[model samples]
Target: MQASLFSGLPDRRERSTAHKYLAFVYCTNKEWARCDAAFDAAFDARPSFALEEYELQNTPWRDAYVKAQGKRGWQCSRPLAGQGSNNRPGQDSANPLVFSLNSTIITAITPLLPAAGGHSMALDGGSPGAFGARRPMRTENNVQLRVSPWANVTLNGKRLGVTPPLTEIKLPPGSHTIDFSNPGFETVRKTLKVEPEQSITITHDFDAR
Candidate 1:
């Protein structure tokens, strides 16, 4: 992942700075695991990094960051707009906004993580509901299939196999191109984005010639 390179820098300050932005990306996408990991990494890399300084330099981004982090149970160090400052005695008014802003910065960089492998794609649950839960089971990830009656499936320009009605294929998380066709049916081509541990299912109906 291009972002992983940011983790390799020898400068703790540089790494922490990059992590702040990356955390924001991950949090925005609701990838809590990755977001939390990035946040922890940032703090661990620079225990004394000044949150106030970070917020002062990146105010608006910080606000959004805080709001995002709040969703994940992190408290903002400063108060919201119109609220009085909460800084400790002798310390800077612990503008709660500082924490809030940093929180958001953590979530903003999740999608950039590299896909699982060359053959995988990312998938999401889409919407919440009973039906949403059913989708994953119905769709398999990265499996080859023949579309019932008589059709062949080609993935990444390579002839794979055929798929049955409502068949699910197991694939790695990332992006992929699928081509479906049969002798008389119109060929359908599609690009799919799959996420890790997510399943994908497709149904095809052929017309008689």
Candidate 2:
């Protein structure tokens, strides 16, 4: 893990950033205690560390970030880095060592929207089990994917393309199945239950798997 590696690095700033990301990882998985711990580690490593304003607004782990600060008996000072409204994490390419990727962005499943610059591909196959079962057209439910190293995706035996995958996946309230497979990693199959207007985020990291 990059977090572990960064923990031992000579630079405290890098370590803090790594732990910040690790917190998001635990947050996405709903591991509350570990999430708080990772944030604590970040602040402990570099007290000057802070997140940008946009991060607090758009990221899925904002709740966890708040809880982490609450556990520390304090609140974070906003945008301590002095980054402007137009600034973003990867916008600066001046330093080769400065690339930071946030893997905790929640991904949504789709019926495959061609408008999102992704050409929707439908694989003709067997009947779509309960997933394809008829229900009200109200797309009141959503399925979000968080798969690492990516995988060939399938929903109820109907292909949904691969991870780093197609977006805008909307479905009616019900149960569905999705399968994730990679060349050497273990294939992951997930059964999702969606209620009206409910969103479920599935997290999978194919490590030694």
Instruction: Give the candidate number with the greatest TM-score.
Output: 2
Best by lDDT: 2
What's model 2's overall lDDT? 0.53
- Model 2 lDDT per residue over 68-158, tens place: 5766677767742433222123344232111122322223333221122211122113543322223334443355555553456677787
List pairs with backbone clashes in candidate 2.
109-169, 110-168, 110-169, 111-169, 186-209
Cα deviation at 141, candidate 1, in Å, is 4.2
Model 1: how far residue 136 lies from native, Å: 6.0
- Put down candidate 1 lDDT per residue, 180-206, tens digits, no spaces: 764434687767665555444343444
> Cα RMSD (Å) per model?
18.7, 14.0
Each candidate's TM vs. the true structure?
0.31, 0.40
